[model samples]
Target: MSSQPVQGLPILPGSTFRDPTKTAFHRSQTLSYKNGFAFKQTPTVGIGGTRLYVNQLSQAELDELSNKRPTLTYGQPKQAPPSDFIPAHVAFDKKVLKFDGYFQEDVPISTEEHFRIRQVGIYYYLEDDSMSVMEPIVENSGMPQGKLIKRQRLPKNDCGDHYHWKDLNRGINITIYGKTFRIVDCDAFTETFLQSQGIELNPPEKMIFDPYTELRNMPLRMYVTPSDFDQLKQFLTFDRMVSLGFVALVLHRILSQRTFPSCVLEISDQEVLEWFTSKDFAVGKSTTLLGRSFFIYNCDEFTRQYYQDKFGITDFQPVNIKKQPPEEIKQIIPPYNGYGFLEDSLQNCFSLIPQPPRKNIIKMLENDRKVLRYAVRLESPRPEDEKRQFILSYCLATDMISIYEPPVRNSGIIGGKFLGKTRVPKPGSSTENPVYYEPSDFTVGAMVEVFSHRFIIVDVDEYVMNYIEHNLESFPASVVESMRNHFAPRKAAKEALKK
Candidate 1:
């Protein structure tokens, strides 16, 4: 047959077996004026195709779509009163009666399979009186499972009557397709429905597990050990005032945490009042609370007094706190760079201005003109320089050192002001930190080096000797002892002359 449309008829060149049109085209499908769909869907048939698409319409569905009613043969259909014609099944659509059941399967091949009990869930729809059975999918069960019975009306036997929701009850046997399922328990709706029907169901039964299943679900043996944790150092370092583990019971969420403390207490007020005030909480008594243990070795004096007054309990030993780590000392002030005194360096660190360090005005006023003087002889290669005398004066107020030479008779050397007043650092001192000479360095028999010339101190003035004796505490012990030794014989000679 050629695939082409008939000429001027608006009919298609296809016909189904039910509605055929003289082997050419169906005339009923060609009626464009009948308000039918203008564009007809073409069938998915190609050249030399063997299979055809079948329309999945039943005779009842076709009759309903065509608005045709079945002819009544059994005495005229009786019409009930409109008030009593209420349909219940339609109103309870999708309501299903669920049950827990299991069936025993016989395995003849293996010893363990001689009896296998497989648990299943059964559901019966109330509206349609249809039922379905489902076997729970087990991991690596090595058996095909799930949907053992699809939802459909099942026959009571080989008869026309099907299984109804009324036939299902807990702790009963439901045989579908020759396999019997023992219903153990049912859901709430099923129980309520059964009771409404005046049928008392058997008490819910537990599922029977075979030996293999029970062995598989058995819990394994285990050994647990307490964990070792250290936080005393951290506790002492961060919050030193936390007296004991009791502090953590309040602040550290001790009730919620799962760690093993010495003794743990819940945060509830009732439990606190019941457990905390007992004699078990007294000093020297050990008590275990929640999951931890605590020893009340000691309490504060106030707490001890309260316990003594209230409970007549005494004898509290002190708790050892040596485990608390020492407080770490941080470097608060930076090191001195040796450019100036420590106070001058500290003042500079605070401000950007390069100001002079604050002076001691009282000390400057008291010792402005006070100077320590010593007679010195310069060591030179020329023999005449050995007799030359030099005076080295150290000013106490400004820490300035000056040198002067006395005019000698018949000496070729002119000696007015030998060295101007300036701070003289010791030989090999850095220029950045010129360590000026101080009064402690001006002593009789001491050596002074200036401008590459070495001079030996020959003597000091009477005022200098008196000052050194008065301020022996300021000098080194060796220098003080030597000065004391030199004055001892003089003091003895003065006493002998008086005698």
Candidate 2:
């Protein structure tokens, strides 16, 4: 068989290197030499007879080829240290944005004993003599969005009795902001007077008793206009409105009546002393008339006489003394010396009154027992393919649960090297155990799987035991024993390795 031409050999065209001159003709030859110097000055023959040469040298010749002198050395230019400066814009981020320095500190207003009405904004008077106040409803841009609404006004009727008049006059002094204004007239006159002063007929603000503001310790005098005095006759025909200060004076007078019965004459000389005392007046200790002094007994007869001469008053009115108790008093008080009256009345009247039951702490605990401690075994046969015991504890006050795990030791499989000689427990093996612990303070619930058996933990420890005993009384003894065994402490958990 003919051998195939050698693959990858370059094929030359016919007569490509042909030359007619015999001088260009040359035969190919191979030369072999043991030393490199044998091929030195060898000539190559082709179009030009260029001489081919090679150099043979020792280690000393190679050493002389490189420069021996040291290169010119120059030190690097010196540089200054970097600056620690920061721009203002860059530093502004560190500042707090409280606007604390720009605003003034607030000063609290006093409100003790005195009723203070907080006026948030301006109160506008309506065309019909009625007043309205504005309350902000929504914010549009930066401005308040609201409408003027009418305020409730006192009734203009004269149907209220002495008790109602007393209540209306008890709050004698009304304070707006820090300033105080006396209630010198009944609600009717006071309402009209307020309107005359250009004050809104209906106060639009919240009127409340200031806990911090207190009434002045000294007694105050009240002055009424002549027109108001004339108008008062139509409103308080049977009784008079008084200030809290005057009521206190009246109480003092009543307490010391035996010693200073004549003191009423002095009071009468200064102002009219009405014998009818209203319950409202007794409660508020406020009065309409302003008198200079509460100790009327201190005034001499001359002063009383001078006041009497000036006001055209001659003598004081006598107080009414009743000979027998009123019908109402007799109804409230039982008859005397009646047979079995006290016992029969107590049985019929007081027996129906309800008494609140006392709290039972033990029953409360039993009814609302919370889980304190719980443990659950978390396992996955694939993916992670590992097992871990999770313990949870509940916080009663905060309503939060905290989780804890057992301390783990490296099983000598760190960094892909088995440095430890101890063998680790296989996954899902009975030898895989968790550390034992006492019941925690509180826990809500837990779901656990132990030994391939599932359990839902609604309660734990004594709570769980008590629930099982009470609620599951019908359960078989074996079933109850199994549940108890599941919650029991593990004795082998303390060991490092399993047999």
Candidate 3:
């Protein structure tokens, strides 16, 4: 019934006892589950019985043994199988988190060694959170090197928690067992794994160089001189987008004012070394490269130190940096060479190709090819010049003028184009920025200059009088009044003829 034995009788180790109430006998199961670690067993004086129901049981489990129902395993899906319950190592399988680390071991007795920096690979088994540290074996090394720490779940504190991958990072000091290991770096997988877990690793530090290890490794090391050809090839093919391309520009400036590989390719490596050693490069002086000027206002500490070492010059005063003035964008509009309006020519300039000469559609349609001819005479002292009449025709569509000399029977002057179809600039104005003649400039008795030749407007055509009268606002008030005064007698005669 209970664990109590008969009075003064000791329970044998292998003996089984019967529960007096239930008449059921039980035997001991296996003693320990694990091999060495965490394996503990309590010796029972009595043997096995039916598994004690913790809280409650199903109706199938409470039934008689002879009852043939499927074995009802309450919480079987949630709980581990009785025979297959093991640690998390089975679930994690073959994944190992590795890190590269080193520890400084003090050397108290040896005269040759002050301290020893031993490199070790830290492997953490993700399965069971167990870890092992191993040092690589060196050929002919006198000191014993191999497995430094065995694989086991290392306890972090007395609370029974173990060291996890979360506790390790680059450039951090972690105490494994008693030895303090400085985590300097890690493999690619470990870095990726830590990052994937949302852990930010510190910047990786360089491992301390060990003189003792260096001496042991000197025999196996091979040194080679760097070739100049590779450097020259790299210099020739360097991308110009990055900041280091400034060096190429500087070099091109050092040789002469030209661009790129051509400027630098002419000089040999020996010449380049000489140029670097030369005293030409200095602060406050501007250098022109790639058609652009750059001022060397200041130098970095390394550059100053290099110059100081090479030339024994120490006075490296920083030249004051001046902010460059912003460039002003000026639009130089070309003079409108024959136009309907200046704005239309500018729009043509913005177009992809040259367009047909622009015309004000409304104005052009209204006064297409309409010409206003005026008879003007040259104001010259010569007797024949005052008598010679020139016909000045002004096209209303484009404000362009053409002059013709009519054939005279005995004037002895050839009648031809006195002026081509072009705009004539007004007098007293420079050729570059000039104002041209308009319809208002050709009023009767008015003096107009056409290329330094002055002419007095004698008379205007009948159409010019009618057109000007129709569009009164298009001309100046004074010109309108003068035209009406010059033509009043002709207008009265025409009106009297009509009556």
Candidate 4:
């Protein structure tokens, strides 16, 4: 195929022009033409290979070539739209302090994706010295004008393909076929970068940085919206404020509210007034507007059932919503949009709901109530039986090993079978002694059995085992038993080979 001629204008490859033949190529890319100045022509394909050469030019083409080129070479492409602006939608709920309007868009044909910001203004109220003051603030509507910088599109599934934008100090980056594109522009989000440098967002400003290497991976979290919150009102607890579980639950409720718009009383307009008057939502008696515990359980009973089904849990009840005293309700729950009284019978039971226990990290880790086994170096050198005796002695001294579970393969065998670096014996029992094993098997996240107790390995790996072998003197029976699994299969296989 012949190389297309460059338009009479200065031509760069891959650029489209109305008249390609009149395009003038750089002298480096062309041979001398009839006009003496090298002109770009389509490639002439021959058996040898593709080559470019100029033949002749008309008087009109000569006249066009004589014109001087424009000084600006890298201005916006003429084909780009004159003024581009992204469109967006915004909604609000009562619990939301503010919602930022921005989203990411998918890119077709390539691995890259684009980000968009909806240009919108939000008005809200903030407390100032115990007084509610109306505040109007403008958060930039969408991602600043820049290229999609570092990005990676995760493999697509039912949830749709997800991509991450690695925001450089200067601009957002996106990955296209594993290549990073660092967008160069005046407007970029460097909120995290500035914060790391001890800068605050009292006054929002565009981030500025020199384009460097393109990034291919980064994390992106969707900011929670107020409508996403839930109000269970069924379960409330005193310790909820101290434990972050309450807050996370409240955030989940808010997420659910945002996700399901039809059921809840949306607080967008005078609807907040209706919700405040509704029996489902009781202030102070039901929930303090800002109480984390109250917000999480304020949903209707059906909503609670939905959550219970979704999480595969039997106990979705929030606990003790009907136990509040009227006097307590009067003191804590403030009246919004008037109408505080819910009549005689209902008002008699006005109390803040009792919440469930908060699930903290410590509590979660301890809930299983299983035995904890750790390998300890023996104080003195000992033989195999002596080592077991010493380990048992220590366990006896500490009362730590009350139970143990033996492996499928017993010891006292010459060889065993190997599976994924673990040794399994060819079916022996308590009648036979268990085999000794190498220390490499019982690292973190591994499984081991001692006497009767089954243990899930935690915190140490092969590297640590090696370190202990070099640093510590002896391996106790518990560790030895765990390590034995690694070599059990090998021993069995070797026995089979001998047979």
Candidate 5:
């Protein structure tokens, strides 16, 4: 049969598969193979051989494939709410308070209620009150306001016995004098005062008293109520009088009623005495006594002298004078000879006491000294079947040998080996009842018998042995021979075989 040329077939440049029967180039513009493989012809460039670039499906093919496949529909796309549609619950306030200054609210007071000024703030009490009518105010102006928007009452009577200040619950309000005010918070001074009085309350979450905004010249207006105004005014007047050196003689009279015959009486102006005695106002005796009189015993040297010169009081003694020991006669007593007279005198005069040497520095110095250590396997004559491993240390200075054994129980050895030293008993003693020996007891190369086992002072540490080897000429021939002959494994093995 004559081979017929396929017409209308698009040429695939650089394609290796040219057999028309096995692989057909279709009009749909895709290459299909009878061997069940579909390949798309792509652009090619010739190097040593044809290089074909595989192409992804074209846009038309992708659209056709997408249409043929069933289109999956998830739920409809989320739609944003209309711009003007606000929820019914949303509320806005037009009249926002812009002032940074503290504002006072009028709190209503009743006969049944009494307000206690606590460190945490003012608290109110009622027989069956469960909640306090106070609003939570957040103070930060720079940040967005907190979510708590409305005024809420705190649970009350939870602590029990509101009459006792210590028992009153925290975060509650008390109506004082027909006005509404929340005890916003308290300060450290107030908290300390309550703690001193044995009244415990929850500490205020925040400090309400701003030092920069606190009015120092005027009394705290927040604490002053209509009922307390007259009393405060009188108290202020009394305070001013005391500041002006006016004595409250009524206090002296009260003290005189309780005074003994030995008490000293200091007389004051008759007019001043009469004025205080006539007034019906509450006179706080402690405040009056502390504020009015200057105790001679508490006076400093300068103050005492001034009082003595001005007031003719010569019997005053300091309240807090330190009692000193009687002076010693240095000529009669022998001086301390422990550290030399001159050194002691210098130390006492200049505070030049010698300090103990640093342990770390001493340890570092000790570390610099070469320590000769060796590991050896020992065999006991009585325990023929058993073998014990020991670490031996040789002291070069004293020519002594120290031996150590592995601990009964491993205490976490790193790197799969117990390299650290374990305490070894003295030659005649057991491990449980250990008795260590002095370094001068053993000489180098000596076969010391320990635990009834012969332990040849076999080896020195590698570094120490190497150092000795390099400086062998400096050492005695006998000493060198002993070091070299110590712990010969071949000789030991031969001796063991003969035994």
Candidate 6:
């Protein structure tokens, strides 16, 4: 047969050979070792007769190569979960945003001495979205491809008085980052997902539980300014990736660095006298327990015992009594009833700075100095016109800005509950300021320290009314008059216009 080049054979391109025998192998190796006939060195042949001839790769050979493949170590970075992981509380409040309004309640007292009987509750949407104040650790286990949606479950308890919206559809279904969660079924998942997220399922044994804790689980009254309202809203939407555990963190920031200490003892001359004379002495025995820190002398048996157990009796005793104080009791100060205030302070103070590994005390102080609002004063009465200064400053600074109308003034103290149709004591009046009562032990709402100025609005009604009436009253008289006019004109027509 006439010589004809194998038609389908891949032409052996010219190549320099280390050895002509090896040249065929080199060509095959470059082609990942395709089976082919080997060539031998021959200096006389054109370019030393080295050539490649293809052959079928057998199934058995392919199987052996596949089995011998080397293991690969993949090195890829991890990714985090989708961004819209919102808490249930936040979603519900946002869903019911439009239903907020002013509401008042009437409370009847069966006392021989009676006063203004109106119990006021101002209703409005305050953002209650549960959100993580702390940012989550971005890790690779979760895929970030999808969106996030938050669901809020309604309270199972009789939260009617505290909740503004009590409709059947009280639950919230919200979309965030392309994921949707049903809140009614959410708390159940807290045990699982939260655990996976590094949260321990069991509360620590040392997590002091008081028999009276149930008593203290009262509804917290909150008053928010327009500025604060805006802040809370921003925290809910943009910061939805945060978890519920972080709320404590946010609260700690507000509580820790507020401009005012948690408690203030404005002692009157009589209070100082009562302290020395009373069997169970107190410097300001009758002073309202309004703020968080409460004082108990070492004399009380129950309190002393409690402290002894918590901090050990020797540590609880005078400092000189111990050789080396137990570190636990050295800082074993009882958890203040107002501990929430301190936690809130720390939470809020930290919020102003950026994320984790909290700033050192010096750095925090430096930042506070730059942002002076968080610097609440902690002080004792000074010799220079202390009482007079305190009263005047309190009058000017306290959030209670309502002009005292005589009947309301006569019946109750500034922050006291109002009894219907009764006279209130005048400021600086001789008569003891009528004993004010709380329907519930007061709760701190939100505290803000701006510059060196600090104001905390605990209950919404008085603070909101005071701020709005004073700050926003400059609208045109014509506008105000027209609004009133529209409402007063034939009821049906006005109603129709509203509809």
Give the best candidate by TM-score: 3
Give the better candidate number (2 or 4) by TM-score.
2
Error in Å for residue 178 of model 1: 99
Mind giving the per-residue lDDT tens digits that candidate 1 earns over 177-268? 89999999998988898899898898999888777778778998867564464456545543422223232132111222323336545566
lDDT of 5 by residue, 102-137 (tens): 224222573432332212123222222222223334
Worst ten in a row by lDDT for model 2: 96-105
Error of 3 at 416 (Å): 2.7
Better of 1 and 5 by lDDT: 1
Q: Note the residue pairs that clash in candidate 3.
A: 26-47, 26-48, 27-48
Q: Write the per-residue lDDT of candidate 3 for residues 1-499, one digit (tens) a residue.
A: 5553433456675354544666546665536768675654543334444554243444455575335333454332465667867677686679788888889889999999999988898999888788999999977767889999999988777787889989988888888678998888988988998899999989888877788878866777667667555555544554332211122224432212112344434535443332232365677666654466776656666656756776887876876645678799886767667555444466666667856665588977887989999999998988878788999999887778899999998789999899888877788865446688888788998888887788989999989989899989999999899989989999899999999
lDDT of 6: 0.30
Worst 10 residues of 4 by lDDT: 389-398
- True-structure Cα RMSD, model 4: 34.6
TM-score of each: 0.28, 0.16, 0.37, 0.13, 0.23, 0.12
TM-score, candidate number 5? 0.23
Order candidates by TM-score, high to low.
3, 1, 5, 2, 4, 6
lDDT by candidate, in order shown: 0.69, 0.36, 0.74, 0.35, 0.42, 0.30
Question: What is the C-alpha local distance difference test score of candidate 5?
Answer: 0.42
All candidates: CA RMSD (Å): 33.3, 37.0, 28.8, 34.6, 27.7, 39.3
Quote the positional error of residue 281 for candidate 5 in Å.
58
Clashing pairs in 5: 106-179, 106-180, 107-178, 107-179, 107-180, 108-178, 108-179, 109-177, 109-178, 124-174
Per-candidate clashes come to 1, 22, 3, 68, 10, 51
Q: Judged by lDDT relative to the true structure, which candidate is superior, 1 or 4?
A: 1
**What value does the lDDT take at residue 347 in candidate 6?**
50
Q: On residues 1-499, what C-alpha lDDT tens digit does candidate 4 reach at each position?
A: 3344344545576653444444443333234486676675543542233233555575577666555234244444467667754332222122212212222244455444343222221112112101111212324523243322222233223565443122222233434335333333222233443455564444333433212112322355667456533355423421122111122133223231222123444456353323321223321233444434454443355444444555543444444335446564344433322232122223333545633333355634643443233332222243532222111111212122332222233443222221122222212332223253334333434544543333444333333444444534455656555544654675699999999
Query: Which candidate number maximizes lDDT?
Result: 3
Off by over 4 Å in 6: 1-11, 14-77, 81-96, 100-126, 129-499
Candidate 6 TM-score, true structure as reference: 0.12
For model 6, how does the per-residue alpha-carbon lDDT over 1-499 read when each residue is reduced to its tens digit?
A: 1122444554355332233232322222222233575543322222224343444455577687666564223334357878997676565454322210111122256243232111111112335622211112235514232212123333334543322232211124322233222222223333344455564443322211222233446777867444333555555553422111111111111211221224356756543222111122232222223443433312334434433554454332312222365566342323324332232334544456634434357645543422101111212254532211111011222112122212233333232221222222323333222232111211123232322223332222333223333434543455334334433445567599899
